[model samples]
Target: MTTDTLVMPSVTAPPHSHRLRQVLHDSGYALLSLPVGVLFFVVVVTGLAAGIGTVVIWVGLAVLALTLLAARGSATLERAQLPTVLGRPVPRPAYLPGEGGPVRRLLTPLRDPQSWLDALHAVLRLPLAVLAFSVTVTFWAIALGGITYGLWDWALPQEGNEDLFELLGFDGGTSLRIVGYTLIGLLAAAVLPFAVRAVAVLQAQLGRVLLTSRAATQAELGRLSRGRDAAVAAEAVALRRLERDIHDGPQQHLVRLGMDLSRAQRQLDRDPSAARTTLAGAGVLAREALEELRALSRGIAPPVLADRGLAAVLAALAARSPVPVELAVDLPGERLAPATENTAYFVVSEALANVAKHSGADVCRVEVGLVGDVLRVVVEDDGTGGAVLVPGHGLAGLADRLRAVDGVLTVDNPRGGPTRTVAELPWA
Candidate 1:
């Protein structure tokens, strides 16, 4: 079977009412852009010209600074209006931080590249806004006029007039006239949505490129950097937890095993019976230590996961869980990306470990399935709930692990009841 696309799926047509509503929104944005754009253009251009004409005077410096400030205000307002067209919040661009003396602070805007870009956008958007407004108004008039032709057609005097049909070598009958106008209206109406959408997109895209593109890129980079940092922190926490567990569990058991063997050796000459009993206890201790090590080792990368697949590894986990586990997996026959499978395995392992250790529940449920381009892993337990993602805690580590690969984690656990952990990962 083929895999589905994992990001930015193809756009599909919405319901008619929704489409019409969106068209109205687009029209409103189009109508508003012209006035807003013109205002910005006039303010920035006038200020810049006046400032340049008098730059020799010290007053020119202040004029230029204030002009940049006016441009920024216009840009901010436009940014706020952008969501109507873009359907996403526009992030404010980071300006140069003001520092040092009053003169230095006043001059900060001149040095900032974003401020210049903002000013440039203010000057350029006026033409685009005019174009969009012209197209939108013209099409809207044609569509509305033609669609309502029948209602208003009889009001016009037709007694001595040669209609357009007559000029075109056809009968100038009223019925034909109305029909023709209505058909023209219908044609314009058919193209109205696309026209509005095009204008809105044009305006929104230009605003985005000029205003927020760089800031958005920087934000994304910051997010990735944070995720990487979280991954490193999670690794550190996991290693520490592993070390503590080993020291407490297997290390202690090994010490006991060693002491048992030593005691048995001393008892062998005094009493063979006691020596045999001590040896038996030592055998049990060895077995327990081996099992504890194996259990801890499973959380790390297990070879069976790579050798067999996710299903086999999940089955093994279910079989070995301390709390009875109910596992359900719905996946394609082929293997997923190694990173995806590894994360899923770790999620299940960690979640189950939490349930067994803290949940006090009789049973836990684990489910893994592919939904569109996302892999969803869910673990639910019917016990005392109140699960939280405290920093340095297991849940937080799990969250970091998921975030490292652009995944998300959510937990739903109220005070007194069941706990649910859900992780969504991009299907690589």
Candidate 2:
């Protein structure tokens, strides 16, 4: 990674789908529902207290306390559900670490802004529930009552003895009576849907605003946190890889080359042909050492990947992979933001490398495509399948690399076979 690009490990799972929208709305409704239930329970308990006569005031205060207790629990449940339903990762309220006293824990939630907002949201729920109930229940009652009056004239007993027919200047029969009820029914029918719909609209807006975090803000926070972690992980991996390369690869080759040179020097006094053979072996060792050094350099972030962009780099990687690899690049020819390009390159490279070394696959497929506003890369190999992400391994390193760029990797290592690694990179 370049000095300008900071790599960090992040939690970059994509948000849940549209199916979660209904889940969130229902959760909001549930959060808002507690106040009405509390209200009902309080009213009943207060009425019971009135029957007892002496303890009505004390009982009312007790009911109030119970309602608040219910509200607090409701808020806690709402906070927990918001992450799953809304796909917003809000931290839960934590108790004070050492002191487990009631006063300290109560003060802790009061001090947190998120907890306060949640409490405020819970408090707002009661009035909203009342308003929603009034609008919905009242409209239905009026509409159904009007319909009943129109259809069943006997149900309008108050209008029976009245000269409503004469008041409308009509014969005192069914027609005048029918028309009055019919007109009321029609008016009520039209207004009812409008009223119910209006309430639902307003409630949805209010609840959505109070409950869900904006997707963009959540994404940015996730990106930054993941980036920091991946950076640390990547730095550590790079250092370890460099150390291994020096110790096992180039250092061994250099040692052999030195031994070869020493042998050739001793043979030069007596047997010129033997000395020539040893010199040839030393030359081959020097070439092998050079190749190992080149491989080490390539491992450290390839210069071609930086200069030519991810498409070209990936195309080259596919060409060189051990298996007959099918490379498909849907990325634009133009370069992306450098960090994003690097992360994508590392993912594809590591995936393909795994295929070559471990996966006994004949052919590997690598795809890079842009879906919606995000870039997706998938690499699949039809090989014996049991790929585990051990710590400090290549795939793990690649996972960390993708995280730095607000991307994620999903690996499928089913017991049956064929491991598939899919990576998603956000365009921004």
lDDT agreement of model 2 with the native: 0.66
- Highest TM-score model number: 1
TM-scores of the candidates in the order shown: 0.73, 0.67
For model 2 the TM-score comes to 0.67
88-187 per-residue lDDT for model 1 (tens digits):
7877767889999999999888888788878988998888799889988988999999999899988888778887778898885888988998899899
Off by over 4 Å in 1: 1-32, 46-65, 87-91, 94-101, 136-197, 254-288, 382-388, 414-416
Taking the candidates one at a time, how many backbone clashes does each contain?
Answer: 0, 9
User: What tens-digit string does per-residue lDDT give for candidate 2 at 306-346?
Assistant: 77778888887888788999888887666677877777877
Clashing pairs in 2: 7-231, 8-227, 8-228, 8-230, 8-231, 9-226, 9-229, 9-230, 10-226
> lDDT per prediction?
0.86, 0.66
Candidate that scores best on lDDT: 1
